[model samples]
Target: MSEIMENPKGGCVLAGINSVLSAIHRTCPVYHSGPGCCMQTTAADQGQSGHKHSCFVSGVSIPSSNMLEKEVVFGGVNKLRTTIQGAVDIIDADAYFVLTGCTAGIIGDDIVSVTNEFKTKGVPVYAIETPGFAGDSSLGYEAIWNTFIDQVIEPSEEKDDKLVNIFGIVPYHDPFWSGTLEEIDRILSKLGLKVNTFFTKKQGIETIKNSSKAALNIIINPWLFKGPAKKFENKFNVPSIRFPGLFIGATDTSEFVREVGKALNLDSELVEKVIREEEEYVYNYLAQAIGVVSWKRFAVVADANNAVAFTRYLANDYSFTPVLVIISEPIYRQEDKERIIKRIENLEYANPPKILFLSDQYEINEAIRNEEKEITLLVGSSNDREVALEKDIQFINGAFPVNERLIFNRTYAGYKGSLTFTEDIYDNL
Candidate 1:
């Protein structure tokens, strides 16, 4: 008997290309697959991030071989070679990377050889065989790092003691990625530490090349990257800290800055001073929004990371109750699922939420309509707006595939992010 699939989240691999492509400005992702994959990546990115951070060749404008039946049966090497060469010649790009899909990856094309040819021509090329069938979009994220570590990054002789690199964020995958990174970057800068958020305006492709120079790599989440971190440590002799999640609220943000201070063995007096000033700034705006957060019940639909992070911020900072949480982060491994459950279970809540690991839109919509307790507020992707409307509750966009507002480096992280988040949600209500 065929096994029944319960609420299958439509799998994608092209999203990986967008993650890497968006990191650097003017970086052309020469898609080595058919036209459909390129179009899908372009369409998805345009719909979400096009308002502010959309790059030179994100969606349909991306260069592609657009493989056909004949190329599928025989090979797409010649077409790809032509495409890359033409792109390098025509497109004024800082870097050129290629991602392959099921068709080209299945055919076992010698992609490395082709990319190396352009590399020999001093074209700044990198390529990885990231097929949708290989894994989810997350794996494509891994591919980008792996290609950079193996191909782009060079050995560093000198390491900066105060320099740290931030890892674990999947750009474009998270709706507020740019703002979040910048927030953390700003906080770290305050502490007299240089930060490299791999995908930033000043530190995009350059981060890949200079990654070896950092003394520490701060992984923003537990479930992000290990292989790349390991490789980085092995090469540069840098230590790393695995922060549970992005520091969203005041207490959490203070704790993160303090912990990072401790990790780097910086002066306690200095760290405390910074935290005090930042917290004061955070709560100054927070005081005005107390009435908004007071006596409110909420439900959130988000990926596992946001579900946990936002829940902590809501409960700890403003006393908003999370009645139900829909964690949409894909759980392929039993351990990942259990980890999320344990994390949510351990969270301190006045009225804990009934958490569901769901991807089905129908199920998620139903979960929000609670007869037991009315959800006064919602924090999640744009899809949850309909449910919020049906329930006549206020909705706050905090996750991926967002619309109705543009996320241009606005964050719900650190002291500034806490204030920004508070004003954002409070103003909406």
Candidate 2:
């Protein structure tokens, strides 16, 4: 059987690692070091069993054990160099991303210098300073995105007309990213705008640089896109419209199209035309499917921004009252947090649901103890699996599924996206 077939759950990565087990060779390269790097970077096929299967299937190109305790205790510049050199000697990828993991981040290793050593040897090396402990996957993405932009985008003689940049919506996090991009493409084409969706599944390196000429930028997710959005605004002066994401139904989709229409200064007739056509299809289906179900009392614990936006949407748009919500991080920028809070306060659900400002899983669990199981709707990570298991409560793991969705499959971003949100609600019925 083929390697892909052998691992029905996308187990081909094991061959990538195991090929290195015997000895580092020309075919197998790309060494990942530091604690948890191996597990965290797997885009698909996660979980302990899946990762272990992958590791056994594909061994490390250069065994990380080469970096001894002395290196950990003091620092591992030499060790990192040795690892990179070994990777260079054995693997033949065009470039290597020397990712800094939790341990390396904590110890403060100068991995840039190590990568530079290889660059001096006339090899293209990219140094990624991603400290795992810092923030959510969005933050990790920003680290890589910023690095890619800095390295690749260059000054050109002149900018092309009708260029546009696509931001937000990483494939792993949002299953519907591919479809979302396509939808965006259709809308922009109608508007007669030329566009570039950087990091499109088969995107080439040149696409990143060409983004400089985009007249406008559309950011799908506000949380992660904030970094790139700011950079694009400052560098390219491209006006950006950030869609807050709709995960309920048609009214939300109409609002999204109208908002984008206004941002582009499109005529009222055109905006209404687009909105009416899309809105009718969504409303007819969703209105029937989303008849006021009794999801009154809800509990949401998610990444800070997602938790906030979802909670607000539930309360104001859907008219469902949340019993308790735990925003996973309190230290996010005030602007982001403020938007969430403002929406919560503006809702008319009598005594509004409490939004917890803490992240301790134990504390969150304790809070949920006060609510009845049938009244609760737990949304967020699969990590909450243990919490649900212990409490005999049903929960929806909104993010971090093993196989990634091609587009924003969660159905929370656009009009159709909002309609899709009813899937879980419909299922629970």
Candidate 3:
């Protein structure tokens, strides 16, 4: 039996790949799919995500083969070759990636062979054969990293002890990705570490190529990049630390700092000093904003990473009652679900909210409507706004498909970011 998903958030895997590649500076994604894929993929992630688009190339501007019936019947190889060459000639990109759509994948176009031809000519082009039907947008994130591990990143004899690479934060898809990465980079910099956020600070293929020199790979998600992380470790000899979830507010952010410090075996004195300074900074703001907003039971509908961060921060940091939390992403593995459940359940003060693994909009709405617990504050994406209104709850746009807000360099991670998040909550109220 098949189920119909209503108003599902996020595009296919192609959109995910496109979003990632486009985020990198001077990197171009040349699509080898039918017409409208370029635009649809762009709209799925970047378009609805905080009204921001890639500065390098995105949306309709990206090159595509636009595989038609003729090309699909006889194979779109030659057309794809020309399209890649044209993109390489016109677009001043440092590297190019050929992303196949369902059309190319269904017709069995040899994208690897075509991309290899460009590679022979010293063109920095790679092929990602995974189509939109392969998986969701998160899979696209992992697929791109796999491509990097296999094709882009090179081994280095010397590793920088102070350098680290960040993973699990998908660009455009998260909407707050740029700001979140920048905030993480800013905090890590105070710890005498150089952070590679990949999507921010004009980092592109060159940064990725040299990422093998990083001392550690910090994956800030509960369940993503598992295979790529293993492959990265085996190939580059660099270890990784999984943070389990994105950190928000002082408690979790401070814990994140300490964890990173411990992983690197950094000086305990320096680590404590940094944590003390950051906590003091946050507490100062907390002191001023005490009782500004009334505490109420809240429900969050977001992806796994944001869902965990929101649930923990609201229940633990703000001392707000959590009633329901719908993880609005497609999570399959039982271990992953259990891990997410564990994090959401083991709250500091409040009881764990009811957690549901849901992606379809209809089911999500029905679950929220049928919740036994009362919800007063709702934190969700734009798509969930209507449901909140129907329930007459206070709603704030906190996750992806953020159509209402213009979110450039705005994040809810780390010490300062938590303040911004608090400010938004207050403002919304």
Residue runs of model 2 more than 4 Å from their true location after superposition = 1-32, 40-66, 70-95, 102-110, 117-122, 133-136, 156-163, 170-199, 221-228, 244-248, 287-295, 312-318, 347-352, 371-376, 385-394, 400-410
Residue runs of model 1 more than 4 Å from their true location after superposition: 1-11, 348-351
Ranking, lDDT, top scorer first:
3, 1, 2
Q: Which candidate would rank higher by lDDT, 2 or 3? A: 3
lDDT of 1: 0.76
lDDT of 1 by residue, 355-427 (tens): 8877767777777775377778889787778878887888888876576787677878777877878777868
Candidate order, TM-score descending: 3, 1, 2
* Candidate 3 clash pair list: none
| lDDT per model vs. reference | 0.76, 0.54, 0.92
Q: What is residue 285's positional error in candidate 3, in angstroms?
A: 0.9
For every candidate in turn, the CA RMSD to the true structure comes to 2.5, 8.4, 0.9
Candidate 3 residues 225-316, lDDT tens each? Answer: 88999999999999999988999998889889999999999999999999999899999989987989898899999999999999899889
Give the winner by lDDT.
3
Cα TM-score of candidate 1: 0.92
TM-score of each: 0.92, 0.72, 0.99
